[model samples]
Target: MKINIQNYESYCLLYIDNELSAAERREFELFMQENSALVNEFNALQQTVLTPETLLFEDKAILYRYDEMEASLPSSFKQSLYREEAKVVDGYFTRTRIIGIASIAAILLLLLGYQFYFSNSINVKNDKENRQTNNKSLKLKSSKDSNNLVRVDANNNLENNTLTKHKSEIAKANGSKLFTSNNLPSLKETDIISQEIKTQDIIIENDVVTNTISSEVTNNLVSDKNAISINNNNSPILNNTNIPSETTENYNTINTDEHDRSIYIANFEIDGDKLRGVTRRINALFKRNKNDKQK
Candidate 1:
């Protein structure tokens, strides 16, 4: 009698048909009052009473069951397809066994095919590599033969003479790079150092003409900070140089001045003396001054 959303529908149908008791009818009336939106639904239920319809099929013969219409296999075909007295069921190959054997045979054939193809590919690659190596050797040999068999005549036409069958080595000025390998030991530290030094002291020009360059040129090259006093004795001679070629009649490039250069140390000036003599006099002066101070 206490109708909810689920049981209210049945209660409403019972109320519509007057099949509900007084208590259920009162509860359903209260439910309908609370849900006034479903009044149309209640009112529409009476019109929804579906009457039994007499339906007629236009193709009534299709619905009829006939003996010939029932599909069935022929006796011989049914006997062939029947598994009841089958030979395979009489302790022979089953469906599972047949399928397993087929899979095993497929795998075996694949393995055998792969092995044959692998072996053939390896053989083909080896044959191709061997052919290439042989062709390269033959080309080198043919080129060498051609170079050695070159005709001596300017027009390269040998009229009567024929080449000797015996192999002969002709000395060629321009030829392929020939490798001359030696079994020398690894270079030591000293050998490496000597090789580097030899490479460092390479002379680009072996012959040089020595011209008499005046002292003015040498003085111009010298800075005031590094001034040098050279007397006429040394003549600016260039030593350790290659001997002048007879073809060039030029003199030595560095030529000393005719007069000696004056040497100045602070206010004191020393002239007309060699460097060694000037150094000795300066030392003697310092010694005398020390002796005087002691006395």
Candidate 2:
């Protein structure tokens, strides 16, 4: 139709968008030529032309304006967010706390172990020194007393004889009474080796319809040469009944029968009446710290 200044902008938009007919387009071009000053406006409107949209927003649900919703932070996050406002949340022994406690316990264990070992060693050393001095004094006294005593018979100086013998026995027996765990073997002489149980698998048929095979286990060490054979009726019989040889040698505990099971600490030696309690523990620990130097 007739293109005016007001409608000319609309015509230019149609032309930029390629929505005008050929006749309308020619008329729009001729109007632009008549108003050469408005050509800049048409050029600006052409720049505003939006290209065809390849990507489209399919979801119309989120586009609708909704009411504001109340938001809440997690308790853990709230505790961190508000320093003074946060109450004492009882997070009973968190992983970090447990780890810290465990670390302290381990340190305490090492400290206690060190104290027990060193203190016991010192006590043992003092006892040994005192014991040696006492033994020497007792020996001197016993010899002199024995030389002076005039025993007419077995009954004469019975008290003196008993005391002398007891003193000598006590001097000779320098070790303290030692106690050790039954399961744990001494490291001094025991050579513990892990042994594997060897096994040989024998195929035994379990078919009920056809040839059914029967298997028998025996304590006999020898296996039959003709272990598998077809019977007269065509059913196979497994005569192999020998148990594995390695199973027999399986031991529940380390065998200390070969030698006397004496408690001996490899690192340090403490001569006393008998090794017992903490001393015996030290003896056991010797096996674990085998590399420790002999002191």
Candidate 3:
């Protein structure tokens, strides 16, 4: 599942050179997919390989010269050469050592430079912070004095507003009393209209109650008709096979009240007798109230 350091570097080099076999390429692709850092490192390595200009020319030249020398010599001489000499001849190994040493020296210098630079930066930042704090303290003191004056001004304005509001409220209350006592219209005419409105509202409430009852009856009749149609369409054998007599009795007993109704009864069952009675009553009422019909 995981490639070790040795294999990881080798695989990266292979991937960069496009030398991986199909299976190896697939493995590396999957590895890159799972590891974002690896993918980034692979990309950087590829960029370096593609653009050798970014690398140190001295290191490259040292290695290149070593390569020429090794290539010029026989393979027998290569095996017999001393480690240091062999490395000098094999330009890659020698250049790696040189580069490594150079890199270490560069890193040391960078660290020292960073320490000095960061320390100076920290000192500068501390000085800036101290100056900013001093400026803020002065600003805050000035703002506090201004705020105190503003608060006093605001208090005086608030007191003036409160007094004005109090006087206005008293004036409005006196005006309301004067209007109510002297300028108010007579209630007798309004009383007649209000009584008429109350009577009309009572009649409207009765109409609403009646319409609600009638709507309920109509809904029940529609449900009964639908159930009857469904019953007639289904095979008698299905009813006999699937439903038992006791279950049918229980189904019929189930309430159709909105709050406590079973889904089957609410959906399918209806009070056919009550619906018919209401329909007949409505017809009779309609006939009796013919004089009240809208023209």
Candidate 4:
């Protein structure tokens, strides 16, 4: 570490003048052992400052004496002597001006270098901050977009589920209306219902019709047959004919003629109480003779 001799000027001067107290002189000697270069520079500066030799003088004798002293000292020590002389002259405005314009030019160059270094550092720091900010903004936008996409998907799924439930509820209401009472559907209403229920994904429209007719006919037949054979077979009978067997396969066959097409079923389920639902042509056709007769 380079100590600033400027702060210890009095101690350095006392040492130079051989006026230090005995204890202070001992401390100074120990300090010199630790910092020879500093002691040598201080000693040289003190000698130059104490001497009456005017640095700006052009006298040949003065110049010759300076040259002789410079030759006797080591190169490093001579440089330090010149440096000390320059420091003293630098403080005096008149002496600085007298030293020529080149010194002023050198100081200006050092100041410009310092200013340029600081400016470039600030620019680099600003550029880094801008890049970081841009990256963070992009990340935030991406996260927001992802969240929006997720919400949109969830909403679409919810809408589809709601539509399905509504269709089911309509089917149930229609089935209950058909099984419990007599209400004839108009031709126009039938056509509209058929159009609404028919899906191109199903094999054929006629298949759906056939399945409905088959379910109704089978239920009626079983009911009528039971009445006829009830006394002959006294075994307790359960009315399970309303539910279609799983052995019934879905038909993929189709016919171009609208009158000769096969029937297909879309859904069939039994509730906890065994109130069977037979969804054939987007509507439930229940096992009620009065409603069938009306239709």
lDDT of 2 by residue, 1-295 (tens): 6998989988988899899999999999999999999999889988887787899788987777655544667799987877565587769897656755665565565456556665765676555434433332332222222222111223324333433343334323322111111111221111111000100000011011012211111111012213111222221111232212222221123233434333234454433323334445554555444544333
Over the stretch 76-157, how does candidate 1's per-residue lDDT look in tens digits?
9988877775454444686555755665565565456545645655665555434433332232232232322122222211
Q: State which candidate has the highest lDDT.
A: 3
**Candidate 3 structure, TM-score to reference:** 0.17
Better of 3 and 4 by lDDT: 3
TM value for model 4: 0.17
The candidate, 1 or 4, that scores higher on lDDT is 1
Native-to-model Cα distance after best TM-score fit, residue 257 in candidate 3, in Å: 67
TM value for model 1: 0.22
| Full-model lDDT, candidate 4 | 0.39
The ten-residue window of minimal lDDT in model 1 covers: 202-211
Best by TM-score: 1
At residue 158, candidate 1 shows an lDDT of 23
192, model 3: CA deviation in Å?
80
